[model samples]
Target chain A: MSNINFKNIKDRQFDAIVIGSGASGGWAAKEFAEKGLKTLVLERGRNVEHVKDYPTTNMYPYEFDHRLETTYTDKQINPIANSCYAYKEDSQHFFVKDHEHPYIQEKEFDWIRGYQVGGKSLLWARQTQRWSEYDFQGPERDGFAVDWPIRYDDIAPWYSYVERFVGISGNRDGLDTLPDGEFLPAFPLNPVEDHFRKSIQTKFKNRYIISARCAHLSKPEPIHIEQGRVQCQNRTLCQRGCPFGGYFSSNASTIPWALKTGNLTLRPHSVVHSIIYDDKAGKAIGVKVIDTESLEELDFFANVIFVNAATLNTNLILLNSKSNRFPNGLGNDNDLLGKYVAFHNYTARITAEYDGLLDYRTDGRNPAGGGYIPNFRNVRKQETDFLRGWAAGFGANRGNVQDRSGVGAELKTSLLDNSKWGNWNVHSHMMAETIPKEGNTVWLDAQKTDKWGVPLLHISIDYASDDWARRDDYYEQMTAMYEAAGFTNIKTSNDPRRPGNDIHEMGGVRMGHDVKTSLLNRWNQLHQCQNVYVTDGACMTSTGTQNPTLTYMALTARAVDHAVKSLKTGTI
Target chain B: MNGNRINRRAALRTMLYIAAGTMVLPACFRESGSKTIGLVNMTINEEQELLLAEVVETLIPSSQTPGAKELLLHLFVLKMVDDCHSPEDQRNFTEGLEGFAAMEDPATGTKFINLSPADRLRFLKQIGDQDNDKITMFYSMTKRRCIQGYMNSKNVMTDLKKYELIPGRYIADFKIG
Candidate 1:
């Protein structure tokens, strides 16, 4: 709480300014800095140093007081954050408190946000599946919002470029719908999972249940080793942050790499208010930032600005950037700045017991990444009742059953014996693609402002009939699969999950070939403002079934490349 | 300098108690408060500690491995009841302990604590199995906390459960014994 006088903001001018330090921002900063641009990364949260700041990384369950349960105060502070399984006592500090941060929810939107240097990158599930040609051509085929400006070939090499540095681990399952990527050795499936994989492969020609392609380094390459990352140790305590730099995080990988370049300047607790626009110049000159601690306003100039402040906030920032040239907001002339928002439907879960796997069990602690069944229903053509498809994350494991009843020596002996563990059980959850609509949007709340005086984002997004239809299909198909696999006690949960709970929210400032229909172009640059790139989740045109962070990274890197080239060519 | 400093371990312990459903009150508030002194505030005499320890030992006695008292599980129970449980739950548990102390063995005509280990076990078991509200509530609460503390103990988890912190590789398909 020390009050410090503001320095000259003009002195902090850079070639490029990236307003985030999460997945997208990290990559943008790295790419820009490596390309010899003096890049400034503005993170609106406290700096969390790698390994050192991961306080609970090496802690044992027995060492923890509540083992792994959230405190009453934790729930009281941020019930939304507590709703997420990752927001336990072990990693409560990483999540934002609901009381401290306020946003208007026209619909029930469980906006799970992390406010730190690494941001949600540290808290992400690390599932990195590539969007296929079918995904890129989805809107055109189905006649949805607007066609994506770019296709699979546009992002494929860039995906490879990021993957080489990040170190993705998976087997090359050469399926056309779910295209393979450059990978390290894949994690082997358990016997029950293997059985299911073989069964699915034999039964269906369309579906392929392969090991999930994740950011964890299964076998550290020279590039990963150079980044000081090692092989993942199957800890499954990734939410606490990886001390080994096992999985990719801004703190562990990209941000650090960017810093090592000597061309990157990281400014933490710099809450950006708006982009400063020059009407005559017809381009964004700089960004106005509010100091989170002292509430002092500072404006820094930059040649280029990459809006990688996650999805909703990116839209909020751009919508708030008003000027004489763009009264609505910067590059928001057509009122498409904060509309057509979408999030993955994670409401469906199917679970069943496999008594036949009594002889076998999954050994060692399984990490967050698991076996993935690529969407099979409507990959080639829209044959289903619904338009879009959903990807299923499948996992199988055995549970230890301690005797809760009885007492004395017998009970103690029973509990101590690992031989008396329970039978194997398999479970799968659906991550369905959400179709973006005009009604589902995020706009600035005119009434309320935060402590920093920035208007709060009013998010009004929900699932449509298509979402429900997908859930029904998910339940039906998964149940049948489990039944066919000779599993008993099969149960499918169709419990409704509120939007933003999946944390895969995208498409507020989406990219399209048409300038009126979208805010950003194919290269992720604003149509009117070439120097300003919005290459985070904000640039996503469609909410594909895959986890969006990897795509965001690739897009950020790709956008930086395009912007840098434009700067040299004098086009921007 | 110390005033601004936070004891992280103590803070973590407090959070654990809170998560376990125990509500610990501030030390400064003890003077102003009435009828809701936390277990952390209360000073249980040596005799009471010994009695609780003996009771836990009976509940989860040692075989070749360490018993409840050997692992100092009674301290965990005391801490949980004092720091974790709600005020109402604490009162119920306190009253239940008193009630348990009063119950006499028919054959020996001695109070529960005064009875032999074997007789005490039988009496406690019979009380535990009873449908009576007081006996059932007390037994279940005590047993649950006792077991939770014991099972999660460093020694137990390390030796018995064979908890590995760093399993270098995940052997997905292994034959279960």
Candidate 2:
């Protein structure tokens, strides 16, 4: 703390400067501010106040110009961002236009991002699950990529630490692969879903399906309640942002806490382009930033720098930051800064219709009503084909009467009349794990630059043969189980979907033991630069088949602790 | 006077005359064009709007609670179709209005409006159940559009059912069926 004397630059500099205010940046800011460090957090987009800024949260679909769907113009302007169903009129403002920051694709790659204060944390599907030993030790077991510097045991306490604060909602299923966390009560499954769960359990001895572990405050704990958060309203308009602070987001939780500390300084509309690496000092003294609104460049100095600008964006910044000592980029000694990119293989799910459940109806309309089956395939025993395993998230609900359609006077009359009948439907989605391939990477495109005059990322990637094989196996197994449960009109589909459709972008500047192979060390501290630490999805050694936000938060919290300790010990 | 001043004076006179003429136009024209119905805003004129509201109210009348009109279902449907529906669908909707006018009540040998409530319901049911593609498509379209309008209304979401802004605790054992 003495080494970082703000008195010397109280009129100019901060003790720490955190880049990107998404999941990781939010945590870093909160931790640094709480620890009494004068921290400055930079966000590329407009400041979004939790409830007030969520203009569409309380708005009904009928009120929207596109009725919760994307317009033709929106699709045309943002081909990649508009691919996801969530990227619609209701929440499109949260995302950046692809054309605005055009990235060349050597192969097709989807880089879905939200460049706001809360970042993608505002729009993330809050299915928070702990990565087991399998995820941490996958590289070691399969000898695919380098092994993870940290293991599940090392991060277990931090996971608990994050869950306790964020208020995760789940059941205490004592599974090894998908470990349970400090959870609020789990949401109930529909009657049909319960039947399917029981039947699947009986048919498959080792496999299990439990309720989805989400980050919604199902029940406000003492900490959550103290933070002035509320319960879930069951109005599944989460992407639009919850006005009640019912879900976990940087806007709803961390940023507000940091602001309350008064030690935090948040500069919105300021996009950090690169870290100013002082070659003589052998440290990152400050960061170079561009104001998205003003189109003006500025440099801010700080002792410690935390790059939480998501996965790809952080890599882009690091790669763009060129110095005399490190010509390739800062911490690019091995030239592995933006290589071995991995994203979840989403195309793995089986859908089926049930006849008897037509009469059964649930009163409350829950937008997020479903259960998840953890990865139980490759944990205790190994699969002959695939090394890693995947998990399934299934949801069941009664179809609305609005599902019916007609034309002319009859159509008009039927719509006006509410006494209509409809059938119930069940849907499911699977998040499959893909092995890290060195060929898949993100590099800088010299031709393209964003509105802020930063170099655009060139993503070159695709699903490997092993990923396709695993997806095939996933479809076959899921179909067999659904058929066994007596579900009729069963249709199974794999994610013929593109790379970024799942919205879980990982890898690129991954953590590893060997400096020659990876960018960051075990503590998420860059090998070449001691002062700079990246704790976003970029720090992930493996892309496990779970929502990665929770893990990112845990890592960010752990890294902040390490950074603070390192500062005290004169390591930086 | 200058050419621009002469032109401006002529334009102003023409605008005043048109505005005065529109004041005497048929109430339907004035009402239909004026109304702007949607989630955030509700702007509808008098006369037939009340009738439309009444028609929807009768279909889902108040029992223990307020009915469709109170829920602003008609307004919501109108706004959604006007704003949200695809331009092609909007064009189809205009053409479909002709099909609606062609509908006759057998009892009265007149349009649907001339019939009693019971007869109206009977006439609608018969046409609604028809297997013809055109008729079925019309029925399906109207049904879907109306449901979209009604269900998404704030009145329906908040007034009728239990609207939990946030159900803090998720009880897995709760009865979902």
Candidate 3:
């Protein structure tokens, strides 16, 4: 508490300025601070203290106003925000209401955001699957976007580095598509899930179903215990924020570590406007920020700046950074600052009832993560009609079937009967990869502006034709698999069909080998501005069918190491 | 009167009408009762509350276990409809409550609240099995709300659902089938 310097933010210069206190920003703060660099973390939202901020952590279902459902007024205010399953009565405080923060949706994009100090880290689904060699070398082989400068080998060590500190719970399934991570004890697969895994493995030669790799401390290591985080209680109400520090959140993990180092100066309500670029110096010197509360503009100088302000906001900041030398906005030499944006297609799903698995019933309560079937479509080659593949998440459970038709004592007896549990039912959703296109981009709306006087970002991204084709394939294959397993009442749906709802928005300021093609280089540094780095979702060259937070943490750690070495050599 | 004051008064009246309708008076203006009712900031009046209590009690009457009235599920139902349900649904609920209050037994023309237990049961069963959309909707909604309130009550959830705050372990297989 004493270490975090809240006062004198206008005076003291920092060694590094990290924008956005999220997954990548927290890592940037920790890595930079641990390396003896004076780091400044600017969070746009209000300050949310660790355990004190989790108000609904101990609340029961009955304690809520709507029994864990959002109010009608709240739903009306945040129609797009409340669409996500997490946007409910218990965790509504964590979400950014749509009325408060508005953006011009040129194509009706659901930009769900959490603007608190921890940002979306407090609201992220903690599925932590690592990308493999296939994911990194995707663009080069298929010829869609520019090639990723760093391969899987470059990031594997960093993945290990981040995974060791933040405990990942998963088994070492020897599959190259979804590479194994350094794991604690994996959560055990339930009887139905185990049966499905075996059946799937036996049926398909090239596929595997394993427990979803999640950033949960199943068995806390000594380092995790030293940080005061305990093992997961499997309560699964993590969107309320974990008081036990059982799951990996910036509020629980990295930001606290960074604060403990006495080198981090956290300034909440400081919304970054743009980067202050120096033409003669050929680098970025500082960032221009506006205080969210007072609406006062301020500048904080730093030797190096990391734009970890999520995917779209990172592009917004970079695109707004106008200078005399680079008039088209910062390092956007080929006008590629906010181009080739993509998101995971999350509309498609398959559900079925398995009457044979009645003997093998799963427990009612579960940790949020489900069994993950890695992308098996184009692992070796593009055998399918689609270009890329999709990852399917599997979950099976048993529920009570209360008799609703009858009234009186019979209905009460039917509901109260202990043996009224239904047969095992299984379901899975397709997180298909969308191709990054030149047309799908985000640019500043010339007409609209936010309350802070920044131009409202006009998002024009949607699912391409390949994404739709891939969805059909996902539905077909998944239904076939369920049928093979002797399941009945097979159902499939593609409702709420829209991009950006998956919340895995990626690739606006992408990395590439050539300076002409992309904004950022192989090291995630902007090509024109060497001192500036965009290592969040903005650095993704291709949208792989994996949960991207783990990859973002690894990339941020790797980029910070490169930046520190470059600083030592006086490269800037 | 101030414009804001008039608007606020109109809103409150509308809310009360939406909860109790013109047939019933507001709870605060009703006869002072000896029963210790926990006053919640909702539009449901005292008589309406008693009617709901009687109605829900008829649905799940006292046997070996506690009934809806014993669990005070009418209060839960009122709070839920007022705060949680949409304004459209709230209006529908209040209109339905008015209809329920106005309904009389076909045999003896006795008001719903004054009917004998068996006659009340038969009347409710007839209402529940009605072909008319309004009658069916009102009966279905009331039944569902009562069931939800009673089922989620502390006694029901703790005893039947066995909801634990912390399971401590992710056991793959449980003994219950």
Candidate 4:
């Protein structure tokens, strides 16, 4: 208690404390605040307000110094960040630069991170799809990781609650592989994409191509307008943070919504060191934090502490939280604090060209990025050499062709020429589900401590053979489908990248029924330590092919509901 | 930074009750002859900037519409090359500009800028023909930055292409034929 400022206990106390202000933590803050509980949210980075802070939101292409291209100096400094497609000059400020915080890579891993108050939610791709029962039963079917303590039915209502507020825009495709959720009007796919949908599904069984579901506002509802967000303007510059609040971000939606309740206190630049566990109480109570500006140490007392510091950092925080009772870490009686890690495989891609749709070209930018083909293989049962199948995005549009040959008015005329439209270029990328393995782990390095005195996280996650096999299956299936649809010049490439490049890493503190094998129980609570919940990506029992943000929000909302009721009944 | 410049320009246009297409250079060029704003990575004199301006203007001449020089795209090219390019490219660009800045006009015994526009174009063509790798490198680099700057110029986006800041509607099946 040497670091605890006891005299200021009244000011430092809270009903609920949330670490990180990204997708899940934002939901935790909103739910607890709406439930009439005073909440404190600790964000380790600067606060970025919605419209006022979106500096490049309305910037035209010409406004960018380098036309939004990554420069040599930028790549030299941000080797990990430059690898991300979203890390451009327009949104570079949102991503964490390598020089900002150093981490050891036992193997090459591109851990794309955004450290602002909104975290990576400010820069997410905004794809929000519901996970199905197949995903929940993945571990049980293939027997890889431990069985998930809860099923899709347990969290389905919470998904509806989250989707209604987050304003998910998706068509209910009546899918058993990818369940439908409460949604607004989905942006319609262009004629070519619809053509592919009609062509592929009629030829293949158990395969469907629906409009890609996203968090954008195709049409704003009353609840959305109440949050000061209007309809999406179709700018497609969402990576720069939409001024319309067209997309759901913590800065635009949850954090502000929680603030309006007057029960939330958001403390920015408060880097959380570790959770403080009480030795005799047999439960967790509060967290130790360091002021990022002055390095002044303090402790925040809370009845319930939710750890939603993304996936890897959550593991880092837990693994560094050594205590007298739990010597290895908090609730480390199982030694599963930083193991069974997995990520989505997104590097494999297939591209082709459609000669038709010559007259009908895509007009506007789709915030949804086009259509989605739900996971077709290993649904209801394992039907492939791989354990799980891949979900893919399908898109087709006309491209602009300008000859940059001659050096005069001919060139200028050619440059501004819009008369010549190229063939309808079609492409699809595989988002395959990777199996979680105990060998793929993230741990705190022994000797390397950061400026905050916390040990640097050592990330050693990699792909298994199933990942490569699944990629091959994706190429094979996509090629056959393209051939069926009369798409020519078809090419497929694996484009081997590191495992964590997908940025959907999960399962360092997975949920399970047994305390010996998992850290969290069914309600996202620590099996040994009550009053603490891990509802973010870290609690995922297995990685599903979906984006994972929507599921994280649903789990956080459900856990808050259960934890709040338990607090009233004195069971937690 | 460049980001702040864009916001300030947008906000200034909104507050000053001016249309967005106004790209006047404050009438300072006639009085001062040649002037520059700032540079972080590379050093350039007023003469060198003037020579670069000539290259951009020659690349895209002004007609009824604003050219690259009128839109101040040359400065953009400078900023991009300075902040965006590698040190080797920057060395070649600066060294290439120096070669043109010091070279005596063969027709008239003056510098390259003193020559007429027709002579300048011919001299540019002569330089283009030379096997000097640095000049060729400089010519191509300037051409690339010039074209990028010209196409993505505010004048081109707002006036020529009509870039919509808020399209509001996404016509999925827009007729293009």
- Which segments of candidate 3 are over 4 A away from where they belong? A1-10, B1-45
Q: Rate the local accuracy (lDDT) of all candidates.
A: 0.83, 0.75, 0.83, 0.86
Q: Which docking band does candidate 1 fall into? A: acceptable
lDDT of 4 by residue, B22-105 (tens): 332322243564445456778776767767788777777665665556566667778788888899999998888777677766
lDDT of 4 at A522: 96
The numbered model that scores best in lDDT is: 4
Candidate 4 stretches greater than 4 Å from native: A1-7, A494-496, B1-37, B43-48, B94-135
Higher-scoring candidate on lDDT, 3 or 4: 4
The docking quality of candidate 1, as DockQ, is: 0.47
Per-candidate DockQ versus the true complex? 0.47, 0.12, 0.39, 0.45
| lDDT digits (tens) for residues A319-350 of candidate 4 | 88889988888998878899999999898899
How would you encode candidate 1's per-residue C-alpha lDDT over A218-268 as one tens digit per residue? 899999999999999988888999999999999999999999998888888
lDDT for model 3: 0.83
Error of 1 at A236 (Å): 1.6
Clashing pairs in 3: B27-B46
Task: Give the candidate number with the greatest TM-score.
Answer: 3
Put the candidates in DockQ order, highest first: 1, 4, 3, 2
- Candidate 1 runs further than 4 Å off: A1-6, B1-55, B74-115, B123-129, B132-138
Residue A54 error, candidate 2, Å:
2.3
